[model samples]
Target chain A: MRERRIIAIASGKGGTGKTTIAVNLAAVMEGPVAYVDCDVEEPNGHIFLKPAITAANSVAIPVPIVDKEKCTGCARCVTACRYNALACVKGRVLVFTELCHGCGGCMLACPEHAISECDHEIGVVETGRANDICFVQGRLKIGVAMSPPLIRAAKAASPSEGTVILDAPPGTSCPVIAAVKDSDFVVLVTEPTPFGLHDLTLAVDTVRQIGIPFGVVVNRCDIGDDRVTDYCQREEIPILIEIPDDRRIAEAYSRGCMAVESLPDVRPFFLQLDLRIRDLLSAPNGVQSAT
Target chain B: MKELVVVSGKGGTGKTSIVAAFAALTPSKVLADCDVDAADLHLVLQPEIRSRNEFRSGHEAVIRQDACIGCGACLVNCRFDAIRTVSNADLAWMFGAGIHACNDCDVCVRSCPLRSLDMINAMREASGEARKTAFVVDPISCEGCGVCVDICPVKAISFPERVSGEWFISDTRHGPMVHARLGIAADNSGKLVSLVRQQARQLAQDQNKEFILVDGPPGIGCPVIASLTGASLVLIVTEPTLSGQHDLQRVAELARHFRIPAVVGVNKWDLNPDMTDAIEAAAVTLDATPVGRIRYDRAVTAAQVAGKSVLEYSNNGVADDIRNVWAAVSALMQLDKPKANREAP
Candidate 1:
């Protein structure tokens, strides 16, 4: 049995059609496909996919709870905490849970064994279906500072035996990294504007640093100038597809309709993308060498 | 100075474009681009950098080879897989494995009997490991946690500030602009944003600027939270798409959570009028004012490509709509001076 290939759709800038590509590709793919929305801060893939959630699990991080009776006011945990999340007030230890990264380093530093971890809910991981496609998404609770943990939970919900497509959050940050990690290939969706070009470079740098094969998909190709194409050509980054600007497509998107469903012309593009991705993965040299 | 931050919970909704236009319109205003992670305002504003400062945030660990014996205690205690044993046999050890994953825990230095490991500088990597064996910390992956510092028996590890990224103050055609670039995959963007905002506010006050317009980062995360805190008003730019509508609600909720006044405006509102109305209704429910909407326009990208604001590049309805939107926003915030009483810039 072969391991399932995971293709991550990411963008350094937001609204570059990362979710559009992820949802439409999943809809048009040949085999059993799992569409994972790892943009926990605003998981929008479900809007296009319109998945009926079958199950949901609360995602939590282990934040330390102090036993005042057992603590000796040693202040070891406060000194050990690097995030400034813990402090000793007079005779008691105070924990600022929002600042905690859930690294569990404080638990090891306590000499009196007074610290115990408790589940602190940050979000939810939901599993569902969009027709024949398996759907999963993470929703971060309002006012939550962290998102990587929830993204990890969403990625974990991927089916073990199918093609998995992860729709990543914008920006080249922790949440984006968590979504694209361990993926077989990264499809970076971007436009041709300066913002898109600048962010595409960053996204490319991030994927290269993470040592993953990736290609670019230009969205809104008709609106912006040709600098993105020039940049990709100069950088030797492969251009997978160019999605032209179409009012019908944008209108469908605004109405929460899949492109493959509303615009027949859009189906072939994603279908071709599905094939192109398969071809890239099966090639001996991988995506970078394919160019 | 009254600060107005322009943000979008979702990315690519013209927050920077709107901010850039605002910068061009305001005569006595300083601009701060707080979207450190993927900052794009600089592309449009094309600022001439007057000052550049290294933004040092987290800490990275280092090992002193001169005082060290080769021990694997650090490798075992590292939870983040940041440490590795370096030997002459593998001269490529620095680039080979676990090179950039240090979390700044000084456990190996503490556990070492001879106390060979010292946390020197968080961002700087040590060189000249030709003869001696030592433990190396991968700076990229280090979270600056002090666990290793706590466990080191020899107390060899030292916490040195790591340069996470760089920030700049620059002169643009519009005014003085502040911006930053977070290093690839580096953390502390929220901290960097706060720093940028601080500098912009200080500059505004020093210059007697009437307004400080902020271009905020995307997502309702740490950086976004930091950008919105203490702002006079938040203008959330969004589209008419379902995702845009959904994200507008989340960002509105965040504004409510932070007790910041928010106004919502849909860019390209004509693409889906129904969704536009829906989003406006949703904004009203969240106690956010439904600001005027802007029509879809290609002038935005054309202006970006030409390195100019929409007001400078086009005279279309989209540009007119933006001006009207600004007027409405100014009126809402009571930032507008009476027409006859205002002095021309």
Candidate 2:
């Protein structure tokens, strides 16, 4: 059986080409591959991949629906709620569905059995196909504050037996963690500028604490200084690929086209990146070999 | 005072760069970087830290090893799966030797002559009362909800307030700035962003400044909402791409939901002029004023590399475009000034 790998491309700072990398890598790979867009807040992988929507499912979380007729306003549910999603005022319990994390603590604490779980749709998960690669994306409903649950839903809908390329949301917050956790490997995409290096350090710290094996891919390598490479070298992290600053690639991306299909020159880099990832994962000690 | 928050639903749409330019353009304003996760405005403004304060929020559960009877209560009750039980030998490798094996009982350490050095083997042969396993919390996974502390049967869990991040009040070359850095992998960024904005507002009011220029985080989530809520105006920076257009509509929708007037600017509009036009038209339908468009200029990257805003680096090309956008935004802000004051009361 071929070794199935879950590779997540993440950058702490936004717009360092996480979606670009994930789509291109999936586009170039020969075997069965799946692309999961876990950036529920934005989700740009579909723009580049142009996936055909095969199925769509609404993702909802359980929010407390209080029964006023139950006759007891003990306020125990409010006290048990840690998210401040519930409040007792004027002898009535008000439930703020948006603030609820769906932890079910309020329901358990309701002495009168007044609280019941109701599904609140936070986002939608879409499953489809973009050419030979399977596609899954989470689109958060506007005005929705929570995204981690939707990200997890998107990941759950992804194909389990294949090379899963997860394009994580920017920032080292709960959403990013939800997308990248349990992955076999992570590709930390970054530019070489000060902003890039600064956020890269945070991303490195996050993946390190998660205990995931990872490497770096420096996009627009020629524009910024050598600081990113220097930092990576000092940290003994592998530089899987260095893509120079190219206008053609940017223009291709702006037109919603895959770089591998639009620009022949960009194909080899992603192909090489795929091989490097396979080599690192197949090694006895993936972390040591990546270094 | 008026607050003008610059936000982008998609990451890397040049929110910080535009904020930096706005800070340089406006003299009597306080700057705030509400993007606590990846705060890069300070890189351009070059702020000098005047005051730094720790940002503490919520609580994390810490189990007292001696009080725990290896009952797995915490592991079973923890909804976040933050608690993990490790063998005595693995625990020794994780925390190292100097620390006490059990703070209260001290049975494991007292039986071993080498303190905790030989505590693993000693624990194995020690009385059955000694715990063979210890529960530890993963700081990242623990949501600081205190559920584990409430559920601990033996009262072994101690809930301590967590220092999630830090906020800084600094003096920039342009004006007084308020910024923050969220602790690595820490939650509660929305709270931290709100703190930065509140401090900036207070600073602006104290200094009698007329404007508070805020650089907001990407996405239309909690942190972004925290940055823009109750603000006088919001300028959404977008690019000329399908993804950019898609994200702009969502962010603009959020702004409309909050009843905040929005202005839009297209960055790198020359990359795809057709998409730029389409986005501007969409912005109009979304009730956002299309201020202006910035041409695709490599000089923007050059300015970033020089650690300066485009306006500070040179007064031409992209700088001129940004200046025009600023003028349009300022006009819109002025038109809504009376409305803002009326809404406040």
DockQ scores for all predicted structures: 0.64, 0.57
* Candidate 1 lDDT by residue in tens digits, B188-290: 8899999999999888878888778899988898899999888878999999989899999999999889888889989999988898999999999998998
Model 1 segments more than 4 A misplaced: B61-141, B152-159, B335-345
Q: Which ten residues in a row have the lowest lDDT in candidate 1 chain B?
A: B336-345
lDDT score, candidate 2, position A238:
88
Identify the leading candidate in terms of TM-score: 2
**After superposition, which runs of candidate 2 have C-alpha atoms over 4 Å from their true positions?**
A1-3, A284-286, A289-291, B69-73, B87-134, B341-345
True-structure RMSD for candidate 2 = 6.7
Worst 10 residues of 2 chain B by lDDT: B93-102
lDDT string for model 2 (A85-118, tens) is: 8889988999888888886667656668788888
For model 2 the TM-score comes to 0.91
lDDT score, candidate 2, position A195: 90
Error of 2 at A63 (Å): 1.7
Task: State the lDDT of candidate 2 residue by residue for B99-149, as single tens digits.
Answer: 222334333332332445445444444424444567899887787666566
Q: lDDT score, residue B161, model 2?
A: 90
Model 1 TM-score, 2 decimals: 0.88
